[model samples]
Target: MGLLWGLIIGGLAGWIAGNLTRGGGFGLLGNIIVGLVGGFLGGVLFRLLGLAATGMIGSLVMSVIGAVLLIFIVGKIKGRR
Candidate 1:
């Protein structure tokens, strides 16, 4: 159940992040991967800042923010190589 929610939220967050940042997404599987990782990153970041989010919407917001940051960073790294 948790895993299912994670995947759904992650996919949505990744898609949103990709569209917001780069004007597109990295396909279904890619989005899922990016989003899941981004969710983890977001949790860590929010904790560091003493921030908290509640419910599905809040989780989605945090995940999207993190996914965007992750995508941006990855883009920069790839551009340099």
Candidate 2:
């Protein structure tokens, strides 16, 4: 159940982040991967900032933010190469 929700949320988060930042989607699996990683990254960043997510929506928000940041960073890195 938890894993299922995580995947669903992750997919949604990634899709949202991708659309928001790049104006496109990463497909289903790619979105899930990005979103899971983004959620972890977001949690770490929130902790560092003394912030916390309280519920599913909060988690989604955090994931989206992290995904966007992740995408941006990756884009920059790729651009530099």
Candidate 3:
């Protein structure tokens, strides 16, 4: 199912983003949440930048980029709080 694939890719993207950002993961649920949101964000960002992601690998890369940006924003916000 498409939802299943989304979850899988999102989880993977989140995991990769976590590792890239903090040298670790955010657990299964965390990763999924982060990944899903990241996917959405990435889609918007890429489109705005005149980019279109296709296929599994493309989707994953976009998600990771968005996730990394999300994490960075969150960190900055948290730090300010």
Off by over 4 Å in 3: none
What TM-score, computed on C-alpha atoms, does each candidate reach?
0.94, 0.97, 0.98
Predictions ranked by lDDT, top down? 3, 2, 1
Residues 1-81 of candidate 1: C-alpha lDDT, one tens digit per residue: 998999999999999999999899889999998899898888888999999988999899989988988998998999998
Model 3 accuracy (lDDT, Cα): 0.96
Q: Best by lDDT, which number?
A: 3
Clashing pairs in 3: none
Error of 3 at 14 (Å): 0.4
The total number of steric clashes, by the backbone 3 Å criterion, in model 3 comes to 0
lDDT of 2 by residue, 1-81 (tens): 999999999999999999999898899999999999999999999999999998899999999989888998899999998
